[model samples]
Target: MSSPTLDDAKRRSTEKLDPERDVETLELAPASEYYVSHPFMRKLLSWGVEARGILPVPREERTDTQYNRIFFIWLSANFNILSFSAGSLGPAVFGLGLRDSCLVILFFNLLASLLPAYLTTWGPRLGLRQMCLSRYSFGFFGVIVPSIFNLASMCGFCILNAILGGQTLASVSGGNLSWSVGIVIVSVVSLFISFCGLKFLSWYERLAWLPVLLVYVVALGIGGKHLINPPPAEPADARTILTFASTIAGFVITYSPLASDFTTYFKPDVPAWKIFWYSYLGLNIPIISVQCLAAAVVVAVPTVPAWSDGYADGNVGGLIQAMLRPAGGFGQFLTVLMALSVTANVAPTLYSFCLSFQVCMPFLAPVPRYVFSVLATAIIVPLSIVGATRFYSTLTDFLGLIGYWASAYAAVVLMEHVIVRKGRFASYDLRYWDSPRKLPTGLAALGACALACALIVPSMDQVWFVGPIAQKTGDIGFELAFAATAVFYVPLRHLELRFRPMV
Candidate 1:
């Protein structure tokens, strides 16, 4: 059932004992040389490229201090303008004031950033895709379990991003266009950027965030001038603190699995603290600014409807159009900038997803990342078109479900990084990532994963399924799942280790 890749994966286990046996240490042509040899350029024009895609980035081509630069911009750009308001959702839902909400978000968001930032440290040394790294804990073949979760999660991601982008698109169109049309427009543009591959992605993100940031500043200046006295801050309660903490932590932790996908070009020697602080601050500042604004808008309007697509009391589009209307040409420019924020957010997500597809099905490795991007986009476009309203309507429950599984999975990955790998990463043979005996037994993680799922069900509260325990406990399913996984996995993993050595 296995080929050279299986041999390769098996060889990697023993190869670690002798550094010379590691293949990744060898040199290769520059990334540009490899790029020119491929047909990527032609594909951009007429779509005739038959290039081999998804090559592991070579070490010689790696960046120094710029190791995680693209990721920094990628995260910030994705925040867009609405993200500030969206950050308000949890605080608003639980009735926290602007001051208390900012404090809760600022603290927990930095806390949640820990695991994902830790993951960024693995990218350069391993050069393996994130899912490929799971082979160690889940077994080469057993990796499919998490892969399935990722694929399902990605579906919701594309849909949600499209919905937001559609809103922005519709906003810019002045109601002349349908939201569904905006959805299609954004989906196509996102897929196109994804088709262009990582080189273009890094460049695009570098340029996109500043303009969006500038627009936010302009809006803030105008709005701050007309502000009224705000309501006195509400004192924090246990209920408010716990609910806000879990929700914001859950949201930030969502990036854990996708962390290494963007950092493949970093040199392994990159300082751990450097990666941690850079990624932490990069993600932290943008999200904080966005949420702070969300709070500010609410404090001012007072009547801002209970938060839906930044359009509840004041549609992001309608509000921007009204506020900026006085500035004439400047207003028009700012409106488009706001919409581009949505585009900037959704586009980079497509790249890692394409890599996820390759991990789930290694045979597709040579199929070109662009091919996967287009086909997947096409399949989901129908879902976006037909189910857009359903998804947008139930965003809250949907996010709850997403955060539930995401947090549990993150718990397992964190445990493995600390207890199993011991935080030292070396080169890997990615091709044989599916070899059975060469990987972990898969029993410990899988058994605990199932147990984690069961444990969360009692605490869960969503639109479709609410645990009875949630009624009494106030729906702490996400927090419970996160803790439950760590509890079960630690002991079970120890037991599993006694039965079979991962080596």
Candidate 2:
């Protein structure tokens, strides 16, 4: 058969696209080469494809101004409202005595939120995706280590979030509906939204925050009345405060790896200060505020009613209902709003998980990124249905574990870009994944850092060598892991390069 023309190839590729197909197997070399070779043609194609939803904004669309890039980064990072809502558990589990708890949250938020900007800014400047950027640290084929790890983590997160969304739905509907049904419903909805791609996801995220804000206001308005009338208060202690602080730290630090994946889309024109302020204010402040409110509610009403023998079964919804009950019809409206807000929270979580997976498996031949996203959602929904509760329990520990690895990965990247090479490396060099001449020191550093972090993580669970620290400090193992990785890798990298120069 004769080689297919460009138009024929495009037609065949589009025709063969399947939602269930694995994107890792897609054959896109011809298309990729066509765009790479023809500069003017590539710009036209990019606009056309992006317009039709087949392509994302090309690098050329990015503004070179620092402020513009920062704004985009801020929007991307702040868009995920789930981060704050999930983190409410920190104060709930640890209680408010730990004044340091807020500090820990602030520190972790700053680190995870800002450091990734530095790494990802390099990506847009170089015009590469996250996985491709890993080539600098992980080395040609070595990039697969982070890629595979990230893919697994993303899938696991999708399942975990689906499970949470299902549980929340089940709680609101009362025990008449099974948890499995709720999980399935949530999974299907998430899958449908994700299958629609970034455009739909972006619109949903922008609107989702509105209901979340409404729920917060309504819940607080009602809950505040209850606080004024005042039930008996539980005495706060030192241990409680420590745990709370540590938990906040753990929650924030755990999200560091995921930050870069979002901020990579920022226009280069965005300023760093704008990115920093918006992320700190728009993202971190709102999130922490929610957590504080949740903590206050738990404190005010120490005894959470058990529905179906589960603690806090109705606590969240009850808070909303209490607020709505005062409004009568308005209250009912707020209740519905609360439910929708919960579902909206899941949208960004699922969307981000899909994007991370797409980056993780860029080598797929037949399936495209959107298809992989849909497939991921399908897999997550079923898992959530069967194991939603158990999955929820595992999320804290699982994120903690992932946190260690993510911190290690971040440490390696920071050391390489900021200290080791002083940011002198060429970004385009990442595309040459087969280069054998490069030192694999970055991969080695990451491995060593991961091992160190793994060793310390169990301590955070009140299990091993440093159980007392975790028990006393909450699960601030993330801080320990991040500190250890940076300290170890930075010096180790220097020694490795000096002792064994790559000639």
Candidate 3:
């Protein structure tokens, strides 16, 4: 009954550190009294959240009750990602007005959020990374397809978020701070949060909301009057609406692969409906609110120049700055609060990016996750700096490309979960994962994605590629990739299921 000795703990940790196996000792060591008193060592190491990856979290270790955890997840969505300007983007990009913009935001945000909600259910049920879950659809080795997309999307978040963080910091500092300087500061802070692990992230998410939330409500309260007299609506045709709706949907869909990473620690008995509503409401409400508010702000003060490279490019920073400008030092405080909020978003994104890498490449699992986080953020620093120039365009195209793969992937997985797997999964069996013959051959997923991509190609207009049909027909091409994939994959997956025993 005595507590295990320090030596026993060390031995157990060493045993789990075997390089041959895809594992690491994610257990925390007790802080010595000296280190605790000094505080610097713990601060340097990011004292918590460094939990095990891939391995099923033991039942006793699963701590969060459903209700309490939802709010933390709720708070997770309250950041620059859902900031007023970013949310208003759906309609703004297409020249839609406040009313139309809000409507589009609400519709697409709700529609796009469904996949993330459905996927959140798998977290507790499977207790595995989403990429690991991909092995069931894609063979272990074949998982590279989705994994690569996921990794790119996640790293995309880091780069974009870092750029935003840099911009936010630089904006708050008046004219003195540089974007590159801001980028490093944000990246370093994110590295610490991610490197220290999820435990730290949870704590940070729980507490960090206070200042930002206060600032947000206060800004809204003071600026509420400006929304009274909205600017006149902009004209929009069918092509413009569809293009804008799809783009907004693409933005929300970008998070589909990342939904479960935040919820995997919930108790397995947690109801699927709870997971759905919590995650859905948490994301949708704040985003919709922000979009509507920003859309209103865009109308009221159309001439307020956004802070961008040498010009007002209608960036969010300038918009927020303009709103809070009337408030003096209060405005400065809010700017800093919002900048820190961007950093908070960075931590979770970086964590997911590294998880995607670790889960995708089992051989790399021998290296500690923190090392991966460092490498990931390091790569993003430069990309973020370069990409920030065309921020809005980069943001749109990046989200759309990732959205294509994510939408198709989610469609197939949702179909398989409902029709083939029936809201159930085989528990924590890497044998079923590591062996390709033992898993589904990935034909359905690959085919569905390729089909989605094929359709997306014709409908696409971006910095990278502009489809002929897209350029001609307002980019509709009349093909709904997600719907097509969902329809196609169901039958394809059934055929694969019939031969399950042959492996």
Candidate 4:
């Protein structure tokens, strides 16, 4: 109390140290000697050291391992596409009349999926994690804000998936198992597997694709026959086309936050074209196929409504019922297949969520990482059970709200690496996780630009705003939002640089 020495002050701030604790328990190496001696730091590091195997090694050494390349590509391709339920729902909600909707889907896919792969390839070349790399755009400390946002978004989606999976389980079981029970069961399993870390998830990915492929093949085989014979087409409309395009874009962009998480494992030596095509084929092609199939099925089956107020909105059950109409007990078979797909999908969602939350720790504490993963699953599962529909709707809005910031992050990184800094950062600089200075001005400028863009973009399209303005306008909210964010950030970034010196 009289006056804590500088050592004491540093010790308090550094949570990774503990002199009284056994050295074996500390997982991470201390940042400084003071950190090594502090009790809290030691405990955290000890846990991190034990769990280090779970994390991808800093980028340079990772390329030495062959499993890294194969698993990374497979995982990136499979994760979002496997959870095809929502993708299936997109076209049904938006009428299929506008041929241009497909173009929108393709464009958004390139922006959300391809752009991030390119950015993450830089990660391996630089040997850094997503949040660490983000310092180029969001300032050193500022990156934390977006990191937290990304983490929350990932967790929220996990909860949403749990809800969807749970509802599927409940429907398949003829309501013998409530959606709540399904949520708990799936969440617990996902938590256990994810706690084992990336290697287990990678293994899951390899095998999970088999069932996903089977389901798709069966759906297409049976459903394709119906399309060939051709049922009368549903009347297409302009509004429906716009809705379809927007929804598809929203779904693709929402998952863009997880892009670097998968690609970080790719070797720096992997050619850009190889990565791009591999990702495009593995991710987008599969997704578009599923979306188109879903649209076709809903259109063909007039009895099944595309949109519903409850948890039964064009679910896998509906897909099976539509596709396998002539076959007996096919719904049950398809239900099982859907369950398998959901399990595969949930594994990576939880795994990525765990990695994101780990960033909030002082350094690399694995126990807390596992604990948080499980805790997140537990929290999300129950909420999802009671609030599946509500949660999905809320999450959709949240993704739309935050997507502008993510887009800005992507733009800033491209500018810094491709234009201003000319991609000159050292690999070791990323590994060390230290900034050249306490703040990064270029990154701050980017964040400010992003914020301004979000505000102005939302204002232009009255539909995005809730008050009298949105009521006066209509559904043009997203178009206004996207344009506003994009246009402002590029120019403001340049002007801000004129006033401020580089950090």
Candidate 5:
């Protein structure tokens, strides 16, 4: 059956055109195209709010050629203090030294970024948001489960960025400003930028890298003397190393759902390999550089009595403050800039979260995407405040949890592209996106996903619970999840096409 959306027919007509003729354009959708057709709301255009939802972009409207922005999009999103803080977890929490933590960050982060890079190429060809693309594999209804999971992951990312930004803010303010206040400040700015939508976000991200890169370089220079390979605080066992590696993998892999969200307006003729490498390098450069530097600094924390004390008082933020303490007033200035830089991270997560939310509940598609951005900020502020209480534990636990489902979901999509669709561009068939009757029932995809999630339970190792297999093998749940999902999905999909040829 066809979706009851007001523009379904318009979308169906557009899908008949050659997708390649459409080149890059990220203009704001007209206010009348929005779900609520009011006269005054047309003024929203003056405010620059992007009104586009899950609908595929038509060929005629695709007109922008600034394809190079794809690199800056991901680079700015990840190159922030939070990425630095994630690396510090290795030395500060897991007891890994410079050698081990850097190794894990290098290998796993590069490995995890590959899938998201691969998915980026789909945007110019399909003109659909990442989650919208999933309807082909999971059908209309079944796509909600994975979309919901993606929402949770993006929310978790926002919360993490807010808390880190808040911590940095509080650290710079000494005892005057509260962490909660910092969270509200960061959340507010992020919400404002996201409400402005894609054009403004793209412009902001393109330049965000300069300031963040400057601060990181200053931080490295200030702490350069302490970058040493200190002895591990405790023994580094296979389980602990595996868990650390997976956490790093989880951080990069989390971007899979939002991969195509930024590239939907690129010209289809923009070489696919350019999209892939730009995206891959964009993610790799910041994550590896910041995380590795943070790890090295944390490894020397024990040797510096002041830094150790700072870590004791403030966790990640405290450690950062202590390192910058030697620089005095100038350091405080940089700290505040570092705190605000988190908006770079928050903008993309908030923007994509709204899209994913609409994908989950289609009824909300008529509402401006910015309205959901406001709602998401409201939810995130409170959670960020609460999660700040146990920052390290929350970081690890949340990463592990999201990694489980993200890995499984990504595996299914990759398998569908290769085995079922045979890596052909035309196989996506945008007309089928909202038509459930023409789509696969999604029973096989959902079944495979459910089985993968279930089997991974036995291999899960988290602070709240530990599985029998995980106790012996460590937290290899992400690895198990990807493997299990691929194995189950291939056979299940084969049988599905056999029984239901039209699907």
Candidate 6:
């Protein structure tokens, strides 16, 4: 495979060369060495129908520089029914008042947003997918661990979103449609958007939030008056506070691994501060608003008969339906649209999940990205069908699991970038992304992850297993994981750099 030289880039600009063909050839050639020899396939790729897989996009191929779009991208992805459901968990399950839940949502989500916000800057700077960038610290082989975890997290998230979307459809239909059918419908819609690749996904996400935002406002208007005043009870115990905080953190922090996937097309010169704030404000605004609204509304579940009955029937979907029941047909219509909003949430996850597989399995790297979107949809549709009844349990446990590794993973990667490499973007060799020998040994990363997991186990609060320490202190496991990984990673990375420096 031939890399595009400065001479080649210059020739394309100066001479009468077909710029599209040259760019396509440059980008797709590295996916498979034989691609350079196949004129028919090269022409096909030049048409841009085939989605680019895991290959690092060349700087010349990157033309997007709309930093402001980062705001809408994350806004649409997170401003959905899933976030509303997450907020309801505070009072619905954890037994906290509206004020306490609001506190948890504001404080923890603000702090958690920082990790992924910073990672979003890497997209333009590195021109690699998030998992592809993981090769820097986790090595080509060791990245498979996070890849697998990310894939599972993606699937888990899809299932949760699909189930809720389906339940809402079912709710709107007055139970005429089965929840399974609704799940399949939303999953297919999301798969279609993701199959169109990054450009289409960006376009869809940019506009997707408008209708959903209107619906959220209506739901809040109708239900906001129902929020209990003078508070229900005193703040919960420390264990409960920590457990709920970790749950919310788990919900938002999982985006860290998928952060760079969206920003890869931006021109590398985009300011880091611009990317950070756009991504940060984009992620936090909807999260804080919808979550706080849900939390406040959920406190009415026990006090309001309609809400209580709604929750009893369809979990989060039912509660929302009852909340909006006052608006009559308009309320029902909004409920349906809110359910459909899952596509915005699921599309990006479905898109990035395919990239993760390409990064993890080399054979799959040559396969077009849309094919993996099909594969992921096939897997998620069935799982969502089977897991439809276990919404709350799945939400709590899966989110807690995400909190465990994502925190540790974020800590190690951030430490490697800031402390080990002194936050120097030039230190990254994008050309060596696919080269194992040129990457880190991953001894420090693996060691740090292992140490964090060992500590995480005893502090995790879950349905299946409650660690002894967790029984006493609640789910501080994620915090412990972050602190532990940072402590272990820096020294170990320094040692590895001293002995096994890459050229």
**TM-score list, all predictions:** 0.84, 0.74, 0.84, 0.75, 0.93, 0.91
lDDT of 5 by residue, 347-397 (tens): 989999988998899777667778889999999999999989888888888
Q: In terms of TM-score, how similar is model 3 to the real structure?
A: 0.84
Error of 5 at 148 (Å): 0.9
Q: Tell me the tens digit of each residue's lDDT in model 3 across 1-503.
A: 33333344334432233243222222424322112222453354454435355543433354567444544654554445335546656555667877777787788788888887778777766556677777777666767778888888888877877777777778777779988888899889878888776667777776776777676777778777767877677677766666666666766776777777877678666777888887788777666776677677666665433322212675566556656666889888887777667666778888878777866787664344566788888899999888878788777666666667787778777777776666445423433444566878888778766766667778876657778767766554223567778878877777777877422
Q: How would you encode candidate 1's per-residue C-alpha lDDT over 317-402 as one tens digit per residue? A: 55555555556778768776776566565665666677677777776764556677777788667777776665433445555666
Tens digits of lDDT, candidate 2, 402-448? 66566667777777677766654332333233243563545557665
Alpha-carbon runs more than 4 Å astray in model 1: 1-65, 91-95, 226-228, 232-237, 302-314, 390-393, 426-432, 498-500
Better of 1 and 2 by lDDT: 1
Task: Choose the strongest candidate by TM-score.
Answer: 5
Q: List the candidate numbers ranked by TM-score, top first.
A: 5, 6, 3, 1, 4, 2
lDDT of each: 0.64, 0.50, 0.67, 0.52, 0.82, 0.83
- Model 4 CA lDDT for position 410: 56
For model 6 the TM-score comes to: 0.91
TM-score of 5: 0.93
10 residues in a row with least lDDT, candidate 3: 28-37
**Model 4 agreement with the true structure over 177-255: per-residue lDDT tens digits:** 8778877777777776666655566666666666666666776775565554434446655444444444455555544
Clashes of 1: 4
**What is candidate 5's local distance difference test score?**
0.82
User: Candidate 4 overall Cα lDDT vs. reference?
Assistant: 0.52
Clashing residue pairs for model 1: 5-432, 84-290, 84-291, 311-315
Query: In model 5, which range of ten residues has the least summed lDDT?
Result: 22-31
- Candidate 6: which pairs clash? none
RMSD to native, candidate 4: 7.7
Candidate 6 structure quality by residue, lDDT tens digits, 1-503? 66443234323432122232221112333333323345655664565543677777666666797787888889998899899989988887888888888998999999989999999998887678898888889888988998999999999999999999999899889979999999989999999899877878888889999999888788778777777473566758988888999999999899999999988889777788999999999999999998998887777777789988888943788887888899999999988888999999899999999999988796666566777989999999999999998898889888878988899989988998998878877667555677678899888898999977888999988879989899999889989999999999998888888877752
| Candidate closest to the true structure, highest lDDT | 6
In order of listing, the candidates' clash counts read 4, 28, 3, 18, 4, 0
